[model samples]
Target chain A: MAKLSRRRFLTETSAAIATAPFISTSATRARAQESRKLGFAICGLGRLSESQIAPALARTRHCRLAGLVTGTPAKAEAYMAKYGVPAGSVYSYDTMHRMADDPGIDVVYVATPNALHAEHATRAAAAGKHVFCEKPLEVSVERCRQMIDACKDAGRLLGTAYRCQYDPHHLECIRLVREQVFGAPFIIEAGFGIDVGGPDQWRLKRDLAGGGALMDVGIYALQATRYLTGEEPVVVSALETKTDPAKFAEVDESMVWTTRFPGGVVAHCSTSYKAGGIQNMRVNAERGWFELDPAFFYNGNHGRRSDGQEIRFPEIDLFAAEMDDFAQCILEGRPSKVPGEEGLRDVRIMQAIYESARTGAAVPLA
Target chain B: MAKLSRRRFLTETSAAIATAPFISTSATRARAQESRKLGFAICGLGRLSESQIAPALARTRHCRLAGLVTGTPAKAEAYMAKYGVPAGSVYSYDTMHRMADDPGIDVVYVATPNALHAEHATRAAAAGKHVFCEKPLEVSVERCRQMIDACKDAGRLLGTAYRCQYDPHHLECIRLVREQVFGAPFIIEAGFGIDVGGPDQWRLKRDLAGGGALMDVGIYALQATRYLTGEEPVVVSALETKTDPAKFAEVDESMVWTTRFPGGVVAHCSTSYKAGGIQNMRVNAERGWFELDPAFFYNGNHGRRSDGQEIRFPEIDLFAAEMDDFAQCILEGRPSKVPGEEGLRDVRIMQAIYESARTGAAVPLA
Candidate 1:
């Protein structure tokens, strides 16, 4: 019977609802027991870890930066000072296994380059810590399988940092296609291209980056096809073009590939280090279509449908959501939405794409 | 100095320049003799001919709709009445060759279905009239070559109705790529798809439509690649998916293809009959990129460069520009920009695409 201001009403109602279920003494005890946050020790001090993951930890409710691991002592010192990490909690790659004695660290987030993902993730699991590795889970399918098995054997949770899987616009696009809102999708066009300047970058190195644009950014295009169709591709045919072979001597400069799904859906995709930045995906169906330009960016992703509908969602911290989701999965004793198997699927497809490009033939996937 | 309005200034300046070049009386007479318009006889009273070609004739500076050919008597009656064409100017398809006796009809524009283009174009050429055939030229490479030979034997110019060639936006895009405005284009993504309704439509018949969406609309995607790169694809790999077999029993429902150019550039393209309308072309180069959505439409085509430059051109009647350009070629005793040879190149590429799709291997273009 009281007329309250909007802010006052919302605050009082939320407080009352929050404490309503804990009124019983047993419920209060259970709530307290389940509210602990996970401590994440990031394994790499690269741009992604320093600029994205560490800052994301500042915003995450269920995860916090508790420790640091780096091969460079300078990087370790810089990250520890920035995040207020205790000197006792810092470890080098050689001493990473010593984290087993540190109860403060719960999960090791492997933010290393593509080639070192499996090594870091496997060691983290062996140390009895949960593992969350950035995409692609590993450079090779076999290595991805090993990482998955190691986590399973250690009875630790494993998650791939496929942040787009938690993005609202991408989720809505997937939902539209899965529900056949536009009628069964028959064609998908997805591409991700970025101009990687300087030939001395790690991405151009065969040992460090694994492949070229496909490994670094083209995986986003590959992932878009799978999630849009919600099915595995049965066959892949690809072509590779290297205009500057001297500059791209170690890996492909650009690649174009076609993927055929089981339900008669075909995806035409491309990735290039030689091209200017472009990230977009389009799905055409029997009745209509939907698309997103800049689909896989950290933010500013918007979508449009054939029926004149625009898909807009509130922007959230992608890394924060991804990290918090993995921590919540560990707390709830559930498997990750983007599990190691999901990363393995993409690795197998990437391998097949490379094979098809090499042999100039269509490679059938198992 | 004269105080002249803008229009009067332009007109007086143009006329004074014209008279200065024709100071001699014979030169003035010769200039008048060279300015007569060409007569265009549309050879199919279908939707495109009725709505686009006939209306465009009203706007052309050097071409006029002087006659009509149709199998349906009612369509002929309707078009003649609508355009104020004399009854004597109408002829049935069986009697189209009699147009040789009518000197008023200078060219026959073949606007029939894909399979009927060869017959109509050849007959028009044999009737001592220049030919302007619609795209895909005739469906098959052999038919296209034969049409070219027929026009050549008759000593008449032949042009394929690739209206996009006359479109200013397309011309600007092509010019940018040809001049290496953004550096040599290394990747191209082009697609054309439309939701063709009903199984009973002529496009669903292999005999009438020649080969479904590729013959009807996919030719645009193929043309975009060639014009943008100014190079032919050396090898092509393709895949076909027919989701609705019952409705698409005689033709492909969807197709995705990859092409490799001589300069190590790759193109990924797709076309589908089951998709909602989508016509777009994007070219990515080493330095920058450019793209056009609705790239192959009759109008409403706009483009943008990666450097934030928007390619905005004044709207012009597509059919009018295409017809006038062909007429000017004939008047100047030269070849058309979109000659029969250009159409043959596309037909060969389309054949390779279909072959690769059937064989599941890359087919080299000869």
Candidate 2:
């Protein structure tokens, strides 16, 4: 036919655009032929980056450390040299969005402190990139929701670094709960605690770390309680402790809390910064009790249970499986095992726990 | 002496008795170089007594099985034959009181159903013997208090069997919690559950066993939580379930409950009969966490950590220690390790749990 009227032409073009596929790097790229050579980038290279995350990333398979981002050029160069990172992939915080322009960078793992996660994640999403955010998902439920929204708006996926979810021992505990091996689970007992003495540590600052160990480690148990019981907490009651006025001036040193579910399941949990480093989770069911003696983070020794058999994970790296999971989520367009909403829910519970602790009453989660 | 008025003679006799030095049993009786041969009598030798108490006594020192009292004469005879008990010591319920006249029996172990414990223990006390009663001293707090009163009236000691309190794993867990190794505890998670195939057992009878698994097993965890925390619970909230109305006709099959203590520590606990066997407890403190993976009533396996060293109680005789403690309490005229009032408080808490479970509201213990 001849040239159409202006309105008809505009309507036809809009319809064509709506029907066509939208392109994103994760969706458009071919799967790397070398299954063991996947590429990934490090966002917010902080202490964890230097101590555990970067080192673990170097040792992981199905993925390799490919790029770095930091405001400090010297630190970036050092990180690149330590991990054999490529030169063109280095990015400043201001120019991190340009990382999307590099085809070699497949995923952006955000290991920054609590407050910076949203900004980095939003920028990465705007660049049409997948994101692996660290814990607390930007310090608040609202921020977590916004990050999720941003990822959805950019047609990308988001994953949170709750490394415990990838832990085999934790997985077995979850299985026992879900399969009713212990019978209808009636209670979950869990906690995370450490003697983090340094006053200058980022975790001691509410603005940078969100709250306390509750935000950092207790969330592991909270998320685990939900995953294990397969029930959402309906009400929460809690208590807070801050022994040293000056050292833990900004955040709580310890927190004890309880969550009640509709199906009569209760989770009793606690987190502390003024205590010795120990992590554990136990579920009591109708049939029998199943437990992981020591849970959460440990390096020298670890244990898991599979089909009633206790399996030890000696000298295992938690960061490897966590990093691999993030890459797979990016490559497959699949949802993360611990998704953005899981992080949001955890933050919501954390907020409720604080509110309850402050008010000396039980706070209901609506 | 000159004939005196009846009232004066009675008063003089009382004065003479009171003025006389308190008799040391050793002075009136012959002393043996070996340890005193303590003899114990078990009443209502059913499941717990047969499976745990009797076998445990066999493995013990400082005590030996001297007699058995059963409602069924056949059971009494059978048990005596199997345990190599003396022929003069077997008695039925009706004759149990007279069996206390037997000189060989120094203590009575009340392992009867909940409802019978009060009567059996009271009679044992009246016969001038020490009493070791199984958990939930009586069906009700009023009855438990009565048992305490009777034992005191008779000048005899009353001890409730809280086996886990003597277990090495649990003892270490308690030490860490009380020492604040995990920090000032803010939350407690305690639970006990077992899958009992609806065997029409006495425990399912409201009149005989008092309540459900809560009265039988959950009380152990509740007592453990309180003993470990050394704090009284001020408020209680609970939910109860019985999926199979026929099986759990007069009792609850499952329960989820909570307790709030003075320092804002909250214990969220559960108990169930339709689940597999599980025994676990956790304390979350301001500084750290203390937990027992295989917490209560384990046959052999147990583990804990204290003072930076892992303590694994591969195998130990908990019952022997429990019996020995009772014996020492009696022989030394010291208070029981877990005295009658402690049992009374646990019963009070249990009653509150049931009431809260029924009312769907928080019941204040205070």
TM-score versus the correct structure, for each prediction: 0.91, 0.78
Global Cα lDDT for candidate 1:
0.83
Ten contiguous residues with the weakest lDDT in model 2 chain B: B14-23
Mind sharing the TM-score for model 1?
0.91
Instruction: Give one clash count per candidate, in the order shown.
Output: 0, 16
lDDT digits (tens) for residues A1-366 of candidate 2: 232243234333322322234342553423322232445678887788888888888667656677788888788888767665767889888998897676556567888888788888888888766678888887888888889999889877788888877777776677777677745766667777777767877888888887877887777778878888777898887766665658878887777777778776777776777765446676766545666656776453344432366645545577888888776655444678888887888888889988977876678897
Please tell me how candidate 1 rates in CAPRI terms: medium
Highest-scoring model, lDDT: 1
* Residue-by-residue lDDT tens digits, candidate 1, B14-110: 3332223212355543453355567788998888897899999989887767789998878887777676665776888899889877666778999
Q: Each candidate's chain A: what TM-score? A: 0.90, 0.86
Encode model 1's per-residue lDDT on A137-239: one tens digit a residue: 8889989999999999888888988999999999999999888898888888898888888887788999988998888888999999998888999989999
The C-alpha lDDT values of all candidates are 0.83, 0.73
Fnat per predicted structure, each in turn: 0.71, 0.33
Candidate 2 TM-score, C-alpha based: 0.78
Residue B177's lDDT within candidate 1 is: 86
TM-score evaluated only on chain B, model 2: 0.88
